[model samples]
Every structure is written in C-alpha cells, then in structure tokens.
Target chain A: MERTTFNALDPNSNVGCGRGSGVEQGAEETIFTEQASDDHVIIKDSCDVTVTTTDIQAAVNLQVAIQLAIALVLSVSIADGSQAQKIQQDLLQRISTKQLIRQKTYIENSRGIEVTMTDAEASVSIQLLLQVLLALVAKLDVL
Target chain B: MNESDQLANKLGELLLGDVLERNGFTPSSKRPLTPEQKQQIRTVLENLQVETERFLQHSQRTIRRESKPNH
Candidate 1:
C-alpha cells in the first residue's frame, strides 16, 4: 500500500516547505490498464515457453513410440502366419530325421565300413561365409 | 553391449517383457521363452534349417562323387 502525508499543509511539513505551487497538486495517476497489459505479455510468454517445451517432449515421445512400433511389426510380421509356422515345422521334422539317420549311421560304422557317410556330410548351418556370390537384380514393380 | 545392442534389448523388453513375465519367466529360469516368443524363435530356426538343407542338397548334387575311400 502507498503511504500519504497531510504534513504539507501542517507546520511539520519540512520536506515540502520549499516546494512551489505545483507541489501541492493531487497524487500522480497510474494507468492500471497499461500495467495489466504488461503483466499479460509476461504471462503469455511464460505459457508459450511451457507449451513449447511440452510440445517438444511430446514429439520426442511420439517418435520413440513410432520407431518401437515399426520395429515390433517388422520383427514379428514374417513369423505371425500359419504358413510360416508350417514351413518351420516341416523343416524341423526334416532336421530331426537327418539327426536320427546320422546317429544310426555312426552306430553302424562301429561294426563295419560305414554304409552311410554321415560323418563326411557337411553340417546344415547358417552359411554366412561366401564361397561365391551370384547377384541378380530384377525389377520388382509391375511397371 | 554397444548402443545398438542396448537399443535392441530395450525394444525387446518393451514388446515382450510383460508378456514373458505373464507366461512364467523368472530371472533365474533357464530359457524362459513365452509361447509367442517360442513360436517366433522356432519359426526362425526352422527357416534357417530349411535354408541350410536346401543349400546342402544343392551342394551335394553339384559335388563330384568320389570313389569309395579305403577305411
């Protein structure tokens, strides 16, 4: 709160004693509307800053979520279907069958010259090593 | 693990961690594969098996037959 003094009219008015005729005029006016507008700008800028930060965080979160979704889809998409399951099951059965054959042949070899060359056979493994690379580029689009 | 490995592990957890936990995977359990994960893993293994077999068959056919080696 602002303080006011009636001492200008009283004998105790030491500071205002030497003042001119304009000194006794009423109190100065303040434009509350202008001050309110300034306060509004400050509030608006603060809100904008907060909103910008929130938007950036939201965008980052969305990007991470989208990337995760795509990866999840890619990882599981090819393996989701029954057709894929069937292919794998058939292949596993074949591997089991080969393993049995290999085991039986190994046992038989103990008695005589091996009838089957199970040990000589190359293993069925991921062939990452390249003996030769044959590249063919085919236009995949119908156009 | 490197950054990519860490990222992959994080993504794996995001996708399957809860599901695996629900399927009775404990930290101490060996190969605690959930039904869905097991199927996916098997599908991949089977694909690899089939591919290896096909390649082996092709190689076998292309290879020259050697005379019976002496024991």
Candidate 2:
C-alpha cells in the first residue's frame, strides 16, 4: 500500500500529478508533483480525487470545537437535575407572575394587553442566562 | 467513580454557589432584594427542590434495580 499526503497554504491554484515509478515485477511507485497555476486542480489515481474549497482538516477541527463547547455547556448546566428544575421553576414563576399582573390589568380595564414572547426573545434570554452562569462557573474554576 | 463524574459534582457545587451569589443570598452580603429579585429566587429554589426530589427518586430506583436478583 502507498500513501501520499499533500498540504498547500496559498490563494493561488495548484495541481498535483502522480506518475507511476517502474519497479520489479512490473510494479511502479507513484510520483506526485504539484503544478502551480491560477486554477487549482489535484489529480490522484486518475479517478479518486477530492477537491476542497477550504482546508478540510481546519474546518473539521473548528466544527469539533464548537460541538465540544456546546456539549460542555449543556452537560454542565443540566448535569444536576435539581439545578435545572430550579432554574425552570424560577423562570416559570417569574413569567407566571407577570402573566397574572397582566390578567388583572385586563380584568380591570376594557383594553386587553397581550404578553407574548417571541422565540427569538426567549432564545436570547436563555443564552444570556447561560452565558452569565458559565461566566460565574469559570470564575470559580469549575469548567 | 469516573473523573468526569467527580468533576461534575464539583461543578455542581460551584454552580449552586454562583446562583446563590447572583441572587444576593450570600451570608455576609447585606444587600436587600427587590420584590422582583425575591420572587425570582423563590421560583428558582422551588424548581430546584422539585428537581432534587426527582433525582433522588431516580437514584433510588436505580439502586433497587442493581440490588435485584436475576429472575
């Protein structure tokens, strides 16, 4: 088995061509060379070539980092069911109290005020809360 | 038993303390809570208590299962 690796770090185009090296028993070792040009093209094994817009490894590493960060945050937050429950309860209570006040006002007045929370608003609030919690945790060296 | 579990336990303690501090529940802290903040803390505590109960129940179930004899 023969393995080859190529790495390029330039905006300009380049091409790698592999040629068979003659050896014993009619076997040949492949030679790989890069051709610099305005258009990048990599030819490997004539039929098994991959074209990438950006560095795939770097992209994969970035994706993994994002996933790990998200997972860490979620796991830390939700690890203790009690804490999660507490937070949920607190949020619900606050929201309910607000709802109650609105209800009372509507009952006292003829005009009705709708207290609706958009998904974006809820998401932002949750994110903010998480960030605050994470910051606190970081300060304590918990993470 | 695992390192991650140990870390999680420590993290839990820290997180609880953080929550309390943010809510001005510190012992030495002399800040008065506004009505809204008080209400919020109460709600959070209530939820936490419920979650604790649920967790205890689940753990108990797991212990029982582990102790059960094979049928």
Worst 10 residues of 1 chain B by lDDT: B60-69
lDDT of 1 by residue, B1-71 (tens): 55643554454334343333443433333222356764654454444435444544443221112122133
Instruction: Pick the DockQ winner.
Output: 2
Worst 10 residues of 2 chain A by lDDT: A100-109
Off by over 4 Å in 2: A1-118, B1-19, B22-71
lDDT tens readout by residue for model 1, A86-105? 33243223222122112211
Error of 2 at B67 (Å): 58
True contacts kept of 2: 0.00
Candidate 2: which pairs clash?
A: A85-B47, A86-B47, A86-B48, A90-B44
Best prediction by lDDT? 2
What clash pairs does model 1 have? none
Write model 2 residue lDDT over B1-71, tens digit each, in one string: 35643554555445545554544433332223356654544464344434333432332110000111112
Q: What lDDT would each prediction earn against the true structure?
A: 0.27, 0.31
Model 2: per-residue Cα lDDT at residue B42: 42
Q: Can you give the TM-score per candidate against the true fold?
A: 0.18, 0.18
Candidate 2 docks at the CAPRI level of incorrect
Question: Model 2, A1-143: lDDT tens per residue?
Answer: 87633221111212322223211232232433233322222222222222222222332333333233323332343445454445434433332211110111111111111122112222222223333333433432333
User: lDDT (0-100) at residue A132 of candidate 1?
Assistant: 6
